[model samples]
Target: MKKFALYSLFAMASFSSLAHAESVLSFGVDPTFPPFESKTANGNLVGFDIDLGNAICQHLKMKCVWVETAYDSIIPALDAKKFDAVLSAMSINEKRKAQVDFSDMLYNTPSVLVAKKGSNLQPTVDSLKGKTIGVAQGTTQEAYAKGEWQGKGVDVVSYQNQDFVNQDLISGRVDATLTDSATATAGFLNTPQGKDFAFSGKPLTDTHYLGEGAAIALRKGDADRVKMINSALAQMHKDGTYQMLEKKYFTFDVYNKKP
Candidate 1:
């Protein structure tokens, strides 16, 4: 009887340790995008996505760990087990769907062109002909520009992150940059460094490139974790937690009404 009790205690302790290990959810993020994920002056991650990820973890009783990753190589890193899921503002496109699974729609925003005021530049092959456009590496904007404008006399330059793209745009190395409207507004255009720039054209709506919306990305075949996150997201929506976080960052609803 004593030996059996001791074995039971050891088994329970081992199971508890395994459960605790499994309860930690690691999220990969590219901290360069503002209003979503970025580091404060003290290197603490702060933004809407960061808050949302923490809320989800709290709701699910899991520990959340953020791993900084480059935007272009985020997917590969996810597959390599560097992190369990990607909590960055990654879009849900067919190309990406083929590589990794994504949670339900988080939010949707339009992509627009930012150029110097009165430049009269538009996001078109003809309007931007012979002009240089900067885009972040591995972004849908990069894919769209490369596919639609690269060979049509438009010079599309790719940067490792959006911050670099915006920097070059300010320096006149690129005439314009195509990026999400929210980031373009909050991260650059609304700041003093981007005072000279303005949205140049109508938002791009090519679903083939712009994608459906942004969501948390997980490795393929991880349906259980995907369902868990989806459930947490649904709960966040139902309990008004999603709106609370959204109000913290944006004035309008970032989560699209349709999705």
Candidate 2:
């Protein structure tokens, strides 16, 4: 999706006791990142991440304060204590682990190549020959698109976010684009411009590039918050609540595995 600029807003309180003895939790996100977290037309932030965050906050009988920031700065902002936790669609990996800790895998997703529907865009090093592909800058998807397709006919076009990429795709500005599979499905196919588009190709599943599953971003040594988020996620998965939310926006569970 779109990598929003620094929205720079204070969400709810950091870590103080809440009203009626409950605890308040803060979650930061890149609001323009769709199918995960993004602002609705009515100005409300609603998406899979929002719903999942809200559910976790509710189950804990606390409030969820959302902070919107640039995708590139989210980790640093979180480490600076701008927010207590990151509910943004951040993946867990070694690079991130050195700076901050993450909760257990909350959801899984894969990266896919999106192009005009019925186009013969195969997932091969050669298929991208002479093709211009779009990707959100600073994302793992961007790295994968460039590194994997470099030296081939693939030309990488980086956009600030998902919406603009879709716009260019509809106008035939780019031959294809690569993004999260979940986003390709919910954010693209459901939109007007994406009605004529579909993501074709096998998922890019290099762990070094895409990382493992997605998790909540937290400060290093913040074990308490991590446990709380992990517990909530485990409950959701156990009770099938995770799949329920997945179906609300997707045809199948796209988490925890590569396509």
Candidate 3:
């Protein structure tokens, strides 16, 4: 009788576990930042984030569904539960922490100022005074530029996305742009239109604006989901899955400089 009772309990527990399992996890991505998230000619989303998100879902035994969002509205959409979490290249800063919780730091990259090789525009308030600088809307670079340089006569223009900023930079629409160095290197500087552009000055770091590093953004108070995602990320690091994805996109370490 005890053996029969034990067997029944085990079956009930197994059924309970299966009932609570999440079958589909929808991720929000901006699809603007290449090497992180972007779309192909066939309209398929691909990048490091896409791969990592899929891996995380695989570990959780869930299907990964990506939802395309604008850079500016992503957080708001998450707040409204339009998607389960944000897997875009979103930096984790205090300002954002107030809006959403973040998983362990997934990666970090330096901010840089990109300009034409001969433009002689340095990334300093005094040097960029009276010059128009471009930055993606709703990004840390935008906040940094507006806070540090806008009042000093620097024209900090906000674009809808990084690709547009790169486009204007190539056409000389703006004197320069402030963006991720790795992104500029891989997505722009290496491209034909960006061949004439070069990054000037050292990497920009701001504790207040730039924050610690990029991570997965989740709705506030979703502790279960947060724990699951963090564990999956740690497992990926331990099993070399993170390294495998990193090798696909970049040569340098993007997961350092924890905040």
Cand. 1 Cα-lDDT: 0.90
Q: Compose the digit string of candidate 1's lDDT tens values, residues 1-259.
A: 9999997787555545543669898999999888898898999999889999999888878899999999999999999999999998898888999999999999998889999999999899999999999999989999999999999899999999999998999899999999988888778887999999999989997878888989999999887678778878999999999999999889887888332
Clashes of 1: 0
Identify the runs in model 3 with alpha carbons over 4 angstroms from their true place: 1-19
User: Candidate 1 vs candidate 2: which has greater TM-score?
Assistant: 1
Over the stretch 1-259, how does candidate 3's per-residue lDDT look in tens digits?
9999997787555534542675788999999888788899999999889999999987767889999999899999999999999999899889999999999999998799999897777789989998999999989999999999998999999999999998888787899999987788888888898888899877888878887889999999886677778878988999999999999999888878842
Worst 10 residues of 1 by lDDT: 11-20
Model 2 RMSD, rounded to 1 decimal:
8.9
Error of 3 at 33 (Å): 0.4
Clashes of 2: 8
Highest lDDT: give the candidate number.
Answer: 1
On the 0 to 100 scale, the lDDT of residue 194 in model 1 is: 93
Q: 2 or 3, which is superior by TM-score?
A: 3
State, as a TM-score between 0 and 1, how close model 2 is to the true structure. 0.84
| TM values, all candidates | 0.91, 0.84, 0.91
| RMSD vs true structure, all candidates | 6.7, 8.9, 5.0
